[model samples]
Each structure stands twice: as structure tokens, then as C-alpha cells.
Target: MSKKVAVLVAGSWGTALASVLAANQLDVIMWTRGEDQATEINNKHTNQRFLPDAELSPRIQATTDMAKAVEGASAVLIVAPSSAMRSVAHQLKAHYKPEMLIIHATKGFETESLNRMSTVISEELECEEGRVVVLSGPSHAEEVVKRCPTTVVVASLDKASAEAAQGLFMNAYFRVYTNRDMIGVELAGAFKNIIALGAGMSDGLNFGDNAKAALLTRGLAEITRIGVEMGANPLTFSGLAGIGDLVVTATSQHSRNWRAGSLLGKGQKLDDVLNSMGMVVEGIRTTQAAHFISQKYGVQMPIADQLYHVLFQERQPRDAVEALMGRDPKTEMEVMTLETWEQWHS
Candidate 1:
């Protein structure tokens, strides 16, 4: 008999991961709220709206019933948008089993609570936080479904849980790495979205490579600063979850955050850009969350602060740029990592 896996909310990333599990010979059950989407996946094996031109594996199925989706599954993967994570996880609370491995691939903070996805899930489930694994890295759902070579990291405070998640997802085409730094992994994953939005806005403004490159560099610095302040390994930001994800999200056309930023840079209103995308742009909400997070941590997140203003305060994109440029000059060596780099260079 094949192993069973449950995936919450059949979005692009969720469906792509389900296909991976199906290919691994697991009975993958995807739970979605939409009757039409569930029917499309159950009968036609195609999720045209999300994964156009791709065929889902025969072993995969979709259902509107949450209980049916997770019932008797060995693992559950939550891929809902950050905004819906809490509610979905709460609905999942009734069906959640202690023995089942829990993993989440969503990459954003809860805007109102300023809590991470895992925290929200743990709060909803009333379980220890360490058991939940986070899946993140440079992997894009678009490329992953095509079986294009992809690598991702799974992290949990519990080593066994991380390894279990790794075993479930790793295969010939999809590679998985394990990390013990759950906080760092989660923080790096969420914070990078804010920078991607900035990078996209830069592109939309017709700023050439020079300007965009500078923005990415500074953006990484901002990410590192916050991650370090929040007890994340500074080196984690340099790893896949940090620099790798940041580079991909900030530059790639496949990145919804970068695309949303690009539209905003072209002087589109936040509402207009969001309406046009027709998909959840996690970075926008993250920027809003980060605005408060920065205050909580007492860390200065200049780029994220600018994005918060641009997305919510009606500040013009160019003006935000000017403000960033006009800020008081300070040596970048304020952080121990940069000072250490300076030491190495000297």
C-alpha cells in the first residue's frame, strides 16, 4: 500500500508539491474550498487556472471536504496564503493527528498578529512549535511542476521531523536539504518577500541593471539585519533561504512578489496592481507586517519601511526611492557580520 499525504488549499505551490508526492507513489489528497477547482483536479487531473499546460499525476486527488483530505494521512502540508493560514489551520485543528508530520511551505507573516506561519499553526493546533517543518528556498512552483531540477530546504526544531519531511519530498528531480534553524529559515523566507517587492518596483521604474543591482544588495543587507536581530543565523541569509531566495524572488519573472513590485514601480496603485495579478502577492502583506515587526525588534529596516509606505501610505514610488537615497550616511559595518567581512578583506 502507498503512503498518504494531505495538502491544504490547492494553489499552484500546493498542487505542484502534490504532484511530486504522487510521483513518489503516495496517495496525495488536496483540500480546496472551491468546488470547481476540486472537480477540475479530481476528474480532469488539470488545474488550468494555476498550473496551465501541466498534467497532474494520476495518483493525486482533490476534495472539498477537509476531513476526507487529511484522514489517515501520514503527513499534512499546509500551503495556504499567509492571510488564510490561521483559519485553514484552525479548520485543520479538528482533524489534526499527533503522529502525522506537519509541514508548511507558505512564506509570509500574519499581518495582524505579526506571527510566523508556524506559530499561527501551532497556536491553532495547540502543539509544540518545534515539530512543524518549514519548506523554502529558490524553488518556484512553475518550474517545480515541470520537473525542472529544483532544490529546497526543510527546517524544524526537531531533527527527526525535518528528516521525515525531507524523506517525503526528496526524489530524483526534486532535491531536499534539512536545517535545524527553524526561526532563521522562517524569518529569512518571510523577510525576503519585502525586498523582492522593492526590486520589482525598481524594474517597473525603468531603472537599469545598475540601480536594480544596488537595490538587491541593499535589500539583502536589510534582510540580514532583521534576521540577525531576530536570532536567525546571519549565515542563513547567505544560504538558500536568504540570498538564494532573495535573488530569485527579486529578479525572476516567475516571482509574484517581483512582478507585483514591477507593476507598482510603473506607477500603478497597490490596489490596481493586486487586482491585475489575480493571485496572492505575499510580499505586500509581509511589508505591512514587517513595518510593525521592525518596531517590535527595534531594528531599522529601511527598504521594508519604504515598501510599507509605498504599499499603504500612498507615497509615490520615486519619492520612496529619493527618501532612501537621501537618508543619513552610515557605514555598513554596523553589523558584526559586515565588520567580520571587513576583517577578512583587510
Candidate 2:
């Protein structure tokens, strides 16, 4: 029998990943809360709302029932938004099997606890932390659904689990790599969204590529700094989950975070920007969490700090840019502590 993989939602990213599994000749069952959406995918083989231009594989199926989705499945991929991850994991607990592989592609921290997605999943599923694998990188759903060439990393402390996830998702068009730095991967994925929002704001304010380039460069520095302090591998920040994902999210028109920041740069109010987005901009909430996290870690994240002020304190976007530019002069590498430098060099 073909391997069966269960996807816990029919959102764009989830649907795209299901299609990738189906392309590998796996039977993919996608679960959604909306009956109409499930019916549409089952009948038309297309999730028009999330993935409009692509035709879904016949091997892919959809159901509204949670148990039905996970029944006898070899793997389950949870792609719910960060805010919904805990509840969705709880819903899957009754049906989840210990032996079945659990993978998640959600990006962002829990707002209240600032926990990574894998941590949240393990806590909710009552599984070992190593049992929860995180799949993340530069790929966007809009492109993935179309079989565009993409690469991503799956990270778990358990190498076998990470390799299993890699095998489950790997195909000609979709390449998956394995990494053990789950902390770095998850943090890099979540933190890059904030920088992406800042990049979009730069463009929206008519700032040229020079500004965007600078943001991307300095953004990686601060992200790596905090990730290292939080027990992540510094080198991981230079990999796919770091500079690679950062570049794509910061510049791509498909990024919802970038779009939200663009709107803010264009002078839209927070409420109005969010309402017009019609999607959860992860960066908005991540900014809130980053603000608290920077304080907690005593890490100076000037860009994230400026972004937090713009996002929460209602500071004007241009003024925020001015503040960033007018900060006290310092060396470019000052963000990386001497200990971090020694660790990286020695």
C-alpha cells in the first residue's frame, strides 16, 4: 500500500505540501475545519481560495473529520498558523500515534510563552521533543504548488526522524535537507519574517535597494545573535533557514509579512493594514514576541526594536526609519559578542 500522510489543514502552505507528498506517490489526506473547503478539494481537486492556479493530485484527499484524516497514516504534517497550533495539536492528540512521524511547517513563536512551534507541538502532543520535526526554509506556498524548484530543511534532535521527514517530502522539484539545529532553524524561520516586514516598509517608503540590502544584512546579524543566545547553532543562520529564507521573505511579493509592512510604510493604520491583509501576518505577532524576547535575553535588536515601536507604539514609519539611522555609531560586527566570535572562530 502507498504510504499515507495526513496534513492538518488546507491552507496554502499545507495544500502545497500535500501536493508534494502526493507527487511522491503518497496518499495524502488533508483535514480542514470548513466543510465547504473540504468538499471543494474532494470534488474539484483544487483549493481555489489558497491555491488558485494549480490542479491538485488525485492522490490527495480532504476531510473535515480529524480522526478520518489521521487514521492509519504514516506521517502527519501540521501547518496551522502559529496562533492555532496548540488547539490543533490538542485536537490531534486523541488520534496521533506514537510511532507516526510528526512534522510541522508553521513559523512563529507562541505569543504568550514565546515557544517555538516544535516545542509547542511536543508539549501538546505529549511526545518527546525530538519526535517533533520542523520543516522550514525559503519555499513559498504559491510557488511550491506549481512544482517550482524549492529547497527546505527538516530539523530534529533525532537524526532518524529528520531523515524520515526528508524522505517523505523529497522529490525532483522539492528538495529537503536534514539539520539537527531545530532551535536555530525554527528561530531563523520566525525571526526572518520581522525583517521581511521591515524590508517591505523600506520599499513602500520609496527607499531603494540599497536600504533593503542593508536591512537584510543587519537583520541577519541580530537574528543570529539572538538565536545563538537561545542555544542555536550560529552556523545555522547562514544556511537555508537563515540568509536564504530571509532573502526570499524580505523581497518576495508573495510574502504576507512584506505586504503588511508595505502598507504600514505607505501610512496605513495598524488596524486598517491588518484588516486589508485578509491573512495572518506572522511578523506582527512575532514582533510583539521579539520585543519581549529581546528584553528577556538582554540582546540589542535595534531593527526589531524599531519595528516593535512602529507596530505597537504607533510610531510613524519614516520616523522609525530615522530613529534606526540616527542610532549611536558602532562597528558593524558589534552585534556579535566576543564569546560568539570565539565560538565561531575557535
Per-residue accuracy of model 2 over 1-346 as CA lDDT, tens digit each: 3399999989999999999999999999999999999998999999998878689999999999999999999999999999999999999999988999999999899999999998899998899988789999999999999899999999999999999999999999999999999999999999999999999999999999999999999999999999999999999999999999999999999999999989899989989999987778999999999999999999989999999999999899899999999999999876667898988887
lDDT of 1 by residue, 229-262 (tens): 7777777888889888998899999999999999
lDDT of predicted model 1: 0.91
Q: Candidate 2 overall Cα lDDT vs. reference?
A: 0.93
Which ranges of candidate 1 are over 4 A from the true structure? Answer: 335-346
TM-score of 1: 0.96
Name the top TM-score candidate.
2
Worst 10 residues of 1 by lDDT: 336-345
TM-score of 2: 0.98
Would you estimate the TM-scores of all the predictions?
A: 0.96, 0.98
